[model samples]
Target: MNTVDEAPRTRRGGRGSRRELRSAIDTTMLPALKRKLPLVEPMDAAQIEQIDRASMDILEDVGVIFRDPQAIADWKSVGADVRDDDRVHLDRGLVRELIKSIPESFTYHARNPANNLPFGNDYSIFVPMTGAPYLRDLEDRRRGPTLDDLASFHKLSHMLPAIHSSAHHIVEPMDHVVAHRHLRITYSSMKHSDKTFMGMTTSPKNAEDVMDMCAILFGDEFMETHAVVTGNCNGNSPLVWDETMLGALRAFCRRNQPILCSPFVLGGANTPASTAASVAQLNAEALSALAYTQVVRKGCPAIYGHYLSTVSMRSGAPMAGTPEISLMNFMIGQMARYYGVPWRTSNTLGGAKTFDAQAGYESASTMMAVLMAGANYVWHSAGWNEAGMHCSMAKFVVDAEQCAMGYRMAEGVKWGDFNEALAAVRDIGPGGHYLGHPHTQANFQEAFFMPELFDNNSIEQWIADGSQEITERALKHVNRLLASYEEPKLDDAVDEALCDYIARREREIPAVDALNNEH
Candidate 1:
């Protein structure tokens, strides 16, 4: 995980020049390998079809409650069976038909063109932990997050090669008013990182404000031609779409921005107890929101998001990185592929309260599941702890190193030019070492994935280095990154315009009650 001091400049030239193409290729990092299909299928085709049918039955018989009047009218206009002014029963055929309009893959543009991400089959992008209200450091101390903490996380995400995007609301800034926090967070992300970022989805006005700020940065016409941001819209489980999320969904969809239409399910609570029944409900909720994206504007990009995790029936505590959740990830991947739409899941999810061994194992297991399942858009890929209640800087660095390993593994085996290796083997036959072989020297840089945060020193070196644990080393790494943090240069005019927009919006929108209550 080598950190570049500055982002590489986008290559200039049309797609014709061979030298320019080579330069472009040299500048871009290695892409995640395309994973083979059906890495782990927990259900057979018949079972999947049965679950699909069950979901369709639920949609038709029980129907989902759409709290927004406009959403209800939109569904009614689309031939859905709307009743009681809120519930809408979507035909399975209509869901399938609307799904057809979604592109299998599309380019998500960034302010820096070189950082654009492609979402589709076999491509996985990792984003940092998001929506956490608390912050933890290597000292094992926890406190409410602030804008400064948020900016630090953004800078770390920008510095890490494994982190593909800086997610919105990386941590809730308790210091700022809820009405004005979104603007400050967005401004920090835009100012600190050049990569793609998510949009604020707390409310429709917040969503609009995010878009207006993006327009100030990337221009309205450029936004029309390219999707520079994405937003997550969640469905209230037990088959309900709340007005707040629907408003955000409409804002993103109508503007052609990508949305993650996710069902945030805690099994045995919001959904049924069984995994199969829970998955069916998840599919139904996700499909309803996805279809609504199309209804807003056909051909809009959307992802089938699954944040399914089972809660402890005894204590009713939410769990993460469980077997049930892993199975759900695999099943959701299969369904996303079947529908020919992109999919998203999480990484580094855990229930552990601290950055301890439990956190390590849980995060690793979940991340491996997402990678194996071929999730295209992964959020919470690093730093999540206490079942997403806190974000840890140490854990973020550790998970990032693990993510680099996952990227290398996704590459599978590369059997390039075996002649040199064979010659070396022949030369070093029978108990001889090939440590000094020519091939080893030539390919060492690309031969292995080097981790930046993990401690691999010998015992003597470790003792000499103060016997620092991984957490301590991680804290040092975080400090080093922030110390060397270089803000990506935005145009002076654009910066001024963004500041003006934020000030103007702050005045227009009165301060509201605190939105983030999870302390």
Candidate 2:
């Protein structure tokens, strides 16, 4: 094991006086831990190969429908069988060859270099929740999320060490106009957090707007050379690709930005009911879209995204953190390894209406599954509730603690010389304690996982302290972080440019109500 001194220091300054002091302290005190892949595969070689062969057959025989004419034409150019009706059949050999060009791993650049995330391999990147319409907390009430709520989530994510990326639309800002809400949410993510972030994928225009904003922050030329942004493209399952998602995919791919080619499938609803069959269909959809990224630009950075879950057949409600989902996460990780591409999945997902026992168990099970599966990009790492319909601030804090625990789990156990621990054990023989031993004193802080919100007080002490529940304690932490948040500084010119772009684009886009009417 490398000494702590060998670990790199993360720079956190350059904004203001307070931030400078905070950054200096953070860099000197806290060293980033390098994560390792120590996962055991759920599927053996034959099972994985079977899934691959089945997926290939689905692509070649059933074929995939590309609703966009350009997509069909692009496939045709590559000698793919593009029927007049927009169904394109891919050659297995061609796909295998094209996918070989994709790099196994790449660095996702962040404005703050210290926050840069490594994709692929053993490294696991955690991102906040995306695309929720409602906000909830310990009060157990749900309401439309506002711009303020969105900013708070961003700040919370920024403050947490476990959350690596401030994902786009952590929650939909319903108060903002639909046509221009992305501008506000993206701006908040950029201004409030210096970490890696995702971009809008609602349409080609939205994607372009996000890129333009990124260019302002990172310079036009830098955007071309570095992947500073990522966007997600969802394939309309049952082997269909909608025009809007395809357009966004093209925009991101053309610029060499990473695109997460995901299939949003709910088993027994959009996909086959059987776990094996659902996985096969999910694999086909994800592979087709991933292959499309290569078709757009060979060697383009892409992630095979799996949003697989089962729906309750009786009530048709989406279920999360199920055994089926865990199996899918493991299977998808194997597939991604086979295809030589990074994969993305979610964590802390729960279908419970509140931050109760049900939510805790469900989220914990799902988080463990993703970590053990060795997911490269983890979204919804925190704050998801009500089956993805709501974002809870309390849950965010709770989940952040869980994520920190996951980091330790991913680090695995150190197998180096244990002389210090052994000596402590010897010194504190039978009927003795090691709490005050020299080695224990030296290593306890680093060896133990300390939770910020979980209560560990004695019963009497707890009563004296008002006996707060986990949710209540989490809210206190949330309030403290929000109160302490200092926006990361940006260059004066870049800040002005970003503001000007948002203003100009807001005027260019139709009003939200008007756009809704048109639709």
Best by the TM-score measure: 2
Candidate 1 residue lDDT tens string, 1-519: 212222222222334443443443222333433555447777789988888899889888889999999898899888999988899999999998998999899887778777877778878888888999898954557998889899989888887777888787888988998879999999988988888999999999899899889899988888876888989998889899999999999888878889999999999999989888898999999999998899999998899986867899789999887998888888888888878999989888978988888898888889888888889998899899998899999898789778878887876777795687788888878998877888887887777776766778899987887887778778866765665555788999999999999999889998856655432
Best by lDDT: 1
Which 10-residue window of candidate 1 scores lowest in summed lDDT? 2-11
Regions more than 4 Å wrong, model 1: 1-33, 36-38, 513-519
- Give per-residue CA lDDT, model 2, range 25-127, as digits (tens): 2211111335675675878899999999999999999999999988988888889988757998888898888788777888878888878776787778788
The TM-scores, one per candidate, come to 0.92, 0.92
User: What does candidate 1 score on TM?
Assistant: 0.92
The models' CA-based lDDT, in order, is: 0.83, 0.83
RMSD of every candidate to native, in Å, equals 6.2, 5.9
